[model samples]
Target: MDQFDWKQLLNPEFYILLELGGIKIGLYVVLFIVFAETGLLAGFFLPGDSLLFLCGIYSEALMKEFSTGSDFLNVTFLAASISVMGILGNMLGYWFGSKSGTYLYKREDSFFFKKKYLFQSKDFFEKYGGKAVVFARFLPIFRTFAPVIAGIVAMDKKKFMFYNILGSILWSYVMIFAGHYLHKLFLSQFNIDLTHYIEFIVIGIVLVTTIPVLMKLLKKKA
Candidate 1:
């Protein structure tokens, strides 16, 4: 069940470059990664809170070197941008789930095709109703599936969009700002290595992203 442990790949330097290298470079990568994490069912475990928080703090750091923007504007842009990414990503994921997922994915099917987790997501949404889309956005595993299941169950598109945008923006701001403030606390309390923290964040994202797969493999072995 052991993976390549790609989580090891992320390091503090990665974040420094990710946020600092250039807007052109860091911007697209962050957008794409965020999309994949939200859209792909396999990506549920990716660190939503931690990732955004880390990016937010690092983005704050970058403001010193580059005219990123006013502090308020920076957070606003990041939150709005993430909102769009999460929503758009869900649209695509839902499309795949609705158009082909029903036939292509069956719960009683083979292990490779089984969407057991999707069923759990369905229950969560049913219990919470439309708000589950927004509510689950904060939870780790459910955050990923709520949208895709919303699509599968034919939750109203307009409703989904409304909640999705609201949730994404709120989630982004909370995490990013939390990261920024936490960084300040660390600095004020004692000298801390920012680079090391960034690297650890990236690695954490990678591990969280891969955890589900590892869990499934472990089940197979059992």
Candidate 2:
């Protein structure tokens, strides 16, 4: 790749790890970010949706760059890897909730800590039950916290696992492959690179998915 291509690839909008040197650090960075976002309480602010989708689009670039006949970055590998990362992230989140999340309500709110987010997540989990695992996957913030709430409520492990696996597969495939195909289609049909505008597209997606929850919260606050 040329210097311009390298600059674009390293752009924070395209790849999450701007300081990590190159896309060769793909799977590790993707998995670690997903796991932290879904598992840790402090990770609620991470850009889960954008990262996954952008990673998918970048995976195509990586595949082309590293194409050694059949040794390219396989699409199935990318999808499955992301799905597994999501599943494990939720599992870890649930574990953390089961261990200490219930007592968190007692802790006084402080810097970087907001009880309202937890309460909102709890309300959603209670309203949706096991289905939240699947539904929250599409919604930002909720996707990371729903599993934590589930564990705090001591929900059935089997049920959580089932939906966790299902949701992970569905969300990962949809977001990742959507970016992949959108990039491909735009390049082929319109000769326009969707990648240039991917950050904006991701913002739109985040807003569309989370607006309902935001409105509900606003109404409740009123």
TM-score of each: 0.71, 0.84
Q: Evaluate residue 13 in candidate 2 and report its C-alpha lDDT on the 0 to 100 scale.
A: 60
Judged by whole-model lDDT over C-alpha atoms, candidate 2 comes out at 0.76
lDDT per model vs. reference: 0.65, 0.76
Model 1, 1-222: lDDT tens digits are 335456533332343345333353555556665687657654444455566767767775444444456877776676677668877877776676666657645546443233666665677789889898887777666676777777778878888888888887777777777776677777778767554567576566556645654674577569
Q: List candidate 2 stretches off by more than 4 Å.
A: 1-23, 62-73, 110-112
TM-score of 1: 0.71
Which runs of model 1 end up more than 4 angstroms from their true locations?
Answer: 1-5, 9-24, 61-69, 107-114, 189-222
